[model samples]
Target: MSREPNHRLAALMAEAGASNKGLAKRIREGAARHGAHVGTTHVSVQRWLDGGGIQSQTASFVAEALSAKLRRRITPADIGFASAPPPPAALGASYAASLPDSLNLLDELAQHSLDDGQPSEILLPDGEVDSAVLSWLVSRPDGLPVDAPASRRVGMRDVAAIRTAGQMFMRLDFLYGGGHGHKALRHYFRQEVLPLLNGSYSAKVGNALFGAAAEISQLLGWTAYDTGNHALANRYLLSTLRLTKVVDSRMMGARILSNMSHQANYLGQVSRATRLARASAEGGRGHATPRAMSLFAAHEARALSSAQDYRGAARAMNEAEKFLEQADTAQDPDWLSYMDEAELVGEFCHCFRDLKRGPESVRFAERAVALTDPQYARTLGFCRMVLAQSQLLNGELEAAVTTAGLAVEGGDALQSARFQRYVADFQREVSVHAENSAVQHLNEQIRAAMAQLDDE
Candidate 1:
């Protein structure tokens, strides 16, 4: 299990005059230049320098960072990763054209993870991402009937079990975030859901089965996303889009595409984020409920905000608010039920914060924090961070520190890397004012609380 020291990477870093921390920052900057994001920390750089593995995509980022520093081109091979026959691209990263292909890709991805324990976190190129989005937009939503290819006779009861499990997973995800129960969810998906895809079913049952399978794929994608496993998460979502189309569920596909937009925004792919959000709206135009439409509009607003289009973002939010007012639970899917006033306000707060309208953000952030249900601690906690961040941006240093401390103190063993990044981002921003005693104390409080969460 011991890894040989990465002499090539180390030598290259030395030649480039980059320290571990500096190189890590450069790598992140490199990813950002490609309109993507990577959470490369100094510790991660140390691991790579010490011969620990880097994802193939991340290795490219590393080379890019060195290339920038040394004023020359660099490749993964130059850093020792591609010296042998290069490894294959990340599985499930590209678009799959057929049902069997999508299912097989998902199966192999799961098996690869279960087999090696460390799923490769390789990032895909931007063009591949664009290609997947384009494929989903053009592919037939009404898929050919699921061929009866297996002996197991799937029925309503079998489909119902998966639906019930999906609900349970949703509740747990809200309560504890994506890190909780993901492994078990994957196991159940591989064990209970994948096989059902090939089993015998009536047309009704086949459509129902594909919908259920798509739901699970969407959940798997979300859980992976929550954990900051960006590459894997993107693959899951791509498959989810294909499956949603297989069921001819334009509404579901809209939701899936909006989810993709959300992830793109997170990774700094602002242009793609906007494009996907618009696609979701276009594709779901006739099929989406008002609530679902509201959610879609919110995603559009988010992407526009990221692109710094204040007017466009405001227009989208107005649409979101308008749609939410007309939303009725009677007609909406159960999943869409969560896109209520509180959620829209939450998105409002996020948009305002992104735009640096601190006071407006504070007002909406406060409402989101107050309106969020207590049982959904992960969300409540995130709302608290937003509130703190808004306060900081507004120059309310005291309020910012106290709220951030509480957000951290309230943190439990809930394992969302996104949540951790929220904490880290605030810490990074607040550190500038650390000359103040209160800011210093809050910093200490944050570290202790984070350590406690990590321990648990």
Candidate 2:
């Protein structure tokens, strides 16, 4: 409401060198991909310049179009459109007692969460996590009903499409961060996947369909955690955990528990984190492959380290390393593509970092950096930052400064709030080196990078 003349939007247009007609056409084209019809013209653009209002969705379109041209992420607020909505207070909280119960809930939750673009500072209550986990622990896996629905004919092709989209969204989250494609992922799930769940299918086809839906739901939880909506993340993960029984996927349930442990640690629930991680390992032992089990053990190592259980942490890491060595990637599920040496080592490095074993942490961090895919900017930046911290602990000031600078560079390219948090936390830790000119210069770089992020 403050920018009555909409000068900010005009300036972005000029900066992107987009004419009124060109920008209007761009918005329409982007909308069309999402099956939205837009009739905007240069005339509408002119009205926006003269202080006329734009729709929230159109505002989002404008911000996205300009971000593409400028090659940086920006919100509607950056161009004086109304700020994106706050995250939902709660989502997908119910632990469905049956497959049919979960289907309707998942459908409703995916649609509800499509509008949750920003994280709320206030976290949701985490007590329900224990309740959901207990429910899942006792729930029996059920086969799809023998009698198929006659609503619409759902087939393997429809399941394939949902599976493909789930993979794509997972990759996008890995590359850019959860804040990047979360809403669009939810939008895709709601639009493309939910309808098929209601369609008619044979028991075999229905099993596959539920599996595909569980994958997307699991990803929705993962992204929600990355975006700092802890409570929302808990609900999504819980819902996905309930869905696992439908598909009879103990491995998937184990993965959900691992994620819950990860979030619990981040939220400072040390004991809960350790419990959840241990549960993942216990429940997934026979059901999960070496790669999946390795990841679960690594998570337990992390939670143990957080609680200052040195011997316990080391034992868990040993198991993880052993399992990692035995991993066979060729037979991995599509969702388990991230369960590799790089991810395993990254977790190991963080665990050591938590245990204050600086040299050991640095060793694992270097391996993580060396093995990490360059496209995974968020994880790479986080590992680099941890390496820098390890260097600082070892009294290697110059190496720490250089590594921290590299982390800052990697972080600036990402759209992840979580990665930004890492950079910020490292910045505070490096304050002890304030007297060194190199450290001060790195500090300046971080400040400028933060400004770039904050300005948007």
Candidate 3:
């Protein structure tokens, strides 16, 4: 699997007039600024110069350092590593405060995504969420009605098209799973949305365009998260939040943060998740639609439950219920329409699961499964698996096996990383009961279904 040396990196270093030791020192220092303590040495620099693969984060730091030295942006792609876009400017930093900068950043991200860029596999630390939240909290909002001029005269039709595409993608994600529409969504952003942003428009139209772009980025981030790509998800989310600031759309901003909270929660960063959830609520504040408020509170409840704060989780869930009572679909954004009673019950099911309250978990899970839309086959199966787990938790072995068999029936209908994890978990739990004929039969059925899917 050996490959050619990355001559581009060596050339860049030479252009920057940095020696091996010098480049390593600068990269180490740059990583320190980003809170990544890399002990890069001259030998590491030599290895990179000789075309050896480096850690993605390390390569990012090297590009960042070179950018500073060369007075221009450098990216992993520029250095002949994997074709990743430049890591975004430090989240919430001054580099992210301007509208033109935000647009440029998102455009770059869109291009990378469309190129099928492979991000580093580094799992973001828990503290990374906290840092991003802090930056957002203190960040100044982008000024309204962009003053910059452009070449082409853009109109509302373009904006409407983007919004319409967003709706389509969202529905696809809901029905099929994040994996189904991800590439198509990225293509839309790159081919359709990027040019719209580059074109000229009146301030009113410009603002609308930015809002549409923000929503697209939010959905992109959500899909990336759903597909188990946390680093990529964070990049999209940061862009979404930044774009929201440019548009000053509090509801959209809140929803984006809530999505981030869910990602953090699933990563087992409960403390970070709780903070992100609260930040989501604060983002919406006085401007929040009832649906927005309910979703934010539900996110917070999930985080609290994960953190083992039962009382706080209960309070948050009650607050969510109160907000749900006030929800008016007419007043809410199209994006929030999916957060209906079934979804709310599903969220409650997760909270109870985290709290290990088996009977309650099973109750909510059953209700969620019953109420879920039939088109959302993957979600229905996932909820059923959750019910099976809860049944097992309550010592109903036979019932658990039966429910799990039902879930396994349509497990391959959609491509979902989360569903795979759920399946693995169910398999492990039932292994203890392998001697039981029911459990054995269910396992055989699941294995057959999965193997069939693989063959197809």
Candidate 4:
């Protein structure tokens, strides 16, 4: 006889705020109290969720924990250790069917947009496609070939179209965050872009398209990561890496790895972040342009800083600087065009700030702000926050408040929760100087802005 599925048990664990480890611990502890010998562990809990049945004695302990924690009676029979039903065929199908159609639609849209020199509209239905299917597609191994002759030639027209789409998606992400516009982008990529990777194109055109698709996938991952959907982000990032490999673009792959490192750092996986960043820097060494190398080194430094390895971070920063000094905009790819001197300075300043090198941080931050575009509000906000913190460290309360105010203004147009957290950090720093008029005013303004955000 087949085993029962543990769907209800999975739901109960989630509702009880029990991680696999926590669930196993609870089971073991509860069983011990009743003088029952059970050898359950986190792995056992995971196995159970994956449809493995436990011994009847151990199941009794799990049931007891669930009953106590959920404040409802739950028995071993209710846990359901039976195998799950097979997933829908459409959900499990390869990209050959779904991806090709999606790409054809996108190609049509692209042609129309290029002809009119206007933004094309794409409205994906909410119900027809399973969100998880896209996730699965991105996670699957990259073995498909591009079948289209026209798509294989990524000309100036294609590049321009990709740039336009990327810019539009970036704007949407900045305005409404990842939740609002990411699905459409993801659907487009899964349906339209992935198929073209294998179509009949020259190596040159195919590689360029691969690079563009990789970038879009990274953006999709960023959106998902920003909104705290870690599993989805990982899938997107993995797909991006796979696409980058098709193009043999180490720099693009490194960038995706750096993003993964950043996500790992934020999630408190410091060791994983460090390892990922190190691997990225190493992988990017020979194939990457100076700008790409510098970017990768900077990412490594950031990860080291997060792990509180000040000396290691400083060394990495120094290497990044050397590469940055060697970088020429003329020789760099269009994707790396945005990594100008100002951005490099900003990255170094951030590293210094993390290491508590206040004076050095302030100097670089001031330069970064001066060189950066005022309209690039997010970067400006970050620079301002760094400057404020540096000034605050140097006991310059008035200067700190002034800088923080600029950060607040710059963050006004940004809807990122991470950016808001930076604002909150600035507010907390200034709140200690409550008696200062400028600080008081800054606090009031921040509060007003937060309130406005809440109302919105």
Q: What are the TM-scores, per candidate, against the unseen true structure?
A: 0.81, 0.78, 0.77, 0.64
- What is the full ranking by lDDT, best candidate first? 1, 2, 3, 4
List model 1 lDDT by residue over 1-456, tens digit each: 888999999899888888877787677556655645455656677877777666667788888889888999999889987843333456676677787888898886665331121332444666876777677767776564555567888899998999999989988888787857677889899998999887888888888888888888898888878877766777888878877767778889889989989988977788888988998888788888888999999999999999999999999999999888888643976566667788888888989999889999999999998898777788888888989999999999999999988887776523576777677778778978879898888877865664455344
lDDT, each prediction: 0.79, 0.78, 0.76, 0.65
lDDT of 3 by residue, 58-177 (tens): 778988989999999999789887753454444222225576787776667665441132332234455665665566666766655554576677789988888899999988887767
Candidate 4 lDDT by residue in tens digits, 1-456: 775556888888888887776676677557646644333546667777877645555677888888889899887777773332321222111222344443443333222111111111111122222232233323433433544545354454674577678778876775566655766886666666665555566556656676787777788778766654454455456545555654466777778777777777765566777877876787677768888888888888888987889999989989988998889743876657667788888887877887788898899889988998765566677788888888887788889888888778654443554465566667766777789889889878876665454444
List candidate 3 stretches off by more than 4 Å: 1-95, 113-128, 144-147, 412-414
| Candidate 4, superposed: residue stretches over 4 Å from native | 1-160, 171-184, 198-202, 227-231, 411-413, 434-437, 454-456
Top candidate, metric TM-score: 1
Instruction: Name the TM-score of candidate 2.
Output: 0.78
Please provide, for model 2 over 1-456, each residue's C-alpha lDDT reduced to its tens digit, 9 standing for 90 to 100: 564688888898899998877776677556645544334556667777766666567677878888988899978888877753444444466777777788777776776442233233233355666777777777778777644656689888988988999888988888878867888988888888877777778888888898898899888888877765565677778788888887678888999999989988876788889988988998798899888999999999999999999999999999999988888643678788777889888998898889999899999999999999887878888889889888877788899889989988865343565665566567677777689899789978876665454335
- Residue 38, model 4: lDDT of 39
Q: Is candidate 1 or candidate 4 better by TM-score?
A: 1
Candidate closer to the true structure by lDDT (higher is better), 1 or 4: 1
